[model samples]
Target: MEFYLFNLIRWILNIYYYILIARILMSWVPGMERTPIGGILYRLTEPYLSPFRRIIPPISFGGMGLDLSPIVAFLAYSFLEGGIFTVLRSLFHWVG
Candidate 1:
């Protein structure tokens, strides 16, 4: 049914959102990227984030730079999730 399909896709996207959060948190720890979990997170999130990185270069503070790609990626993901759910709701005649 469309209801179940919509929930399933929503659940998957929610999991991906959590994965992105985990990846962001993992970056704070030194050498975290070398670990297996970190590697998995990197593989899952990098493709989604790389284009944002290309579009927006990091902010430079003398030698150390602050990467804003993840923040941009999060905002973009929120919009994308909203749009997908909107289309799905219309297709399913969802009331809420």
Candidate 2:
């Protein structure tokens, strides 16, 4: 049971991490958001991305501007997934 839970959580986090990547790619395409999948991706990813955006803001170098929030979000996801995996591994070992 515990192993199943650990795998499930890991799987979910992995999937969401990929979704974030996809959302980043979709943003560069013109008029993608009007389509169904694009809209779904937007809705799914925005909640996770919003806080990072608030903290980082968009940065400008000359005429070009870049959003740093997605990079921060990916870093956060890596941290979260590593912590959860470590805890789950230790707990499983302790219990079993």
Candidate 3:
């Protein structure tokens, strides 16, 4: 039971981590609004991202554009999910 819970937690973290990356990358590419699949991906990602937009605006490079907030969020989450978890695991020696 404990093992299953650990696995579930890890899976959720990785999924969200990847989703955040995917959504940010998708923004750089064109045609996300034109296709159905792309639209759905945009919809799934936008709700979480929209709130951050106001807090952290996108960067502009000449005519091109980039958003660094999602990358920042991913790095932050990675530390919490990966680094912090490792630290806690070592500190407590709780899991095998």
Candidate 4:
């Protein structure tokens, strides 16, 4: 039971992590965002990203813009995953 739960949690995290990476990659390809799949990805990622975007606005350097929200978003997700894994591991350890 615990093994199934752990794998499920990791799978979910991996999916979200890939989605986030895909969102960033999609931006570089012109007109990608206009496609249906791209739009769906945008919609799914935006809610979580918007807050970080607001907090860390794009930094301008020599007329080039760098969006840091994605980096922050990934870091935040790592923290969340770590905490979840820690709790679940302790639970399973106690039970076993």
Candidate 5:
């Protein structure tokens, strides 16, 4: 039961990561606001991404534009999943 809880938490976090990644990709393209699901994903992701955007501005590729903040967020997620989460799992396994 406890293991299931841990897995659930991890799964939720992974979903967040996927949404964040999607938001990053969506930024380059317009018309995201036209879709209901896209609107929700944008709303869910903007709060976290905005703060990072303030710190790290987007890079201009000639007439094209690409933001690197999502990559940073992805790295952050990877670190949390690979480092702290793994440590917590090991601890939980040991304890229960």
Candidate 6:
């Protein structure tokens, strides 16, 4: 049961990770967010990314700004995934 649960959670997290990456990549193309796929990606990822954005404002150089929220979000995800798996392994003795 623990093996199944762990795999399920890992799969879901991997999908969301890809979704976040897609959303970030979409930002590179102007008007991409207005497209159907881009809109879906934005809706899926923005809720997770917004708090980080609020906490860390974008860095500016000249007129352009580089958003670090995605990087922070990724780091947070990595920590969260590690912590969750650690607990699961210790509690259930499920080796991955």
Model 6 residue 54 lDDT score: 98
Stronger candidate by TM-score (2 vs 4) = 4
Each model's TM-score, in the order given?
Answer: 0.92, 0.87, 0.68, 0.88, 0.77, 0.93
Clashing pairs in 2: none
What are the Cα lDDT values of the candidates? 0.94, 0.88, 0.70, 0.90, 0.76, 0.92
Off by over 4 Å in 2: 94-96
TM-score of 5: 0.77
| lDDT per residue (tens digit) for residues 42-96 in model 1 | 9999999999999999898789788999998999999999999999999889956
Q: Which pairs of residues collide in candidate 1?
A: none
What is the clash tally of candidate 1? Answer: 0
lDDT agreement of model 2 with the native? 0.88
* Runs in model 4 lying further than 4 Å from the true structure: 94-96
Judging by lDDT against the true structure, name the best candidate: 1
| Pairs with steric clashes in candidate 5 | none
Question: Weakest 10 consecutive residues, lDDT, candidate 1?
Answer: 87-96
Tens digits of per-residue lDDT for model 6, 37-64: 9889989988999999999999997899
On lDDT, who's better, 1 or 5? 1
Q: Write the per-residue lDDT of candidate 3 for residues 1-96, one digit (tens) a residue.
A: 655666777888778767767766676667765578668767777776676666788789787666777766665566788775676567666675
- The collision pairs in model 3 are none
lDDT of 3 at 81: 86
On the 0 to 100 scale, the lDDT of residue 67 in model 3 is 70
Candidate number with greatest TM-score? 6
- TM-score comparison, 5 vs 6, better candidate: 6
Prediction RMSDs, each to the true structure: 1.2, 2.2, 3.4, 2.1, 2.6, 1.0
lDDT (Cα, tens digit) per residue for candidate 5, span 24-77:
677656897568878998899888778777878878889765678777877777
Off by over 4 Å in 6: none
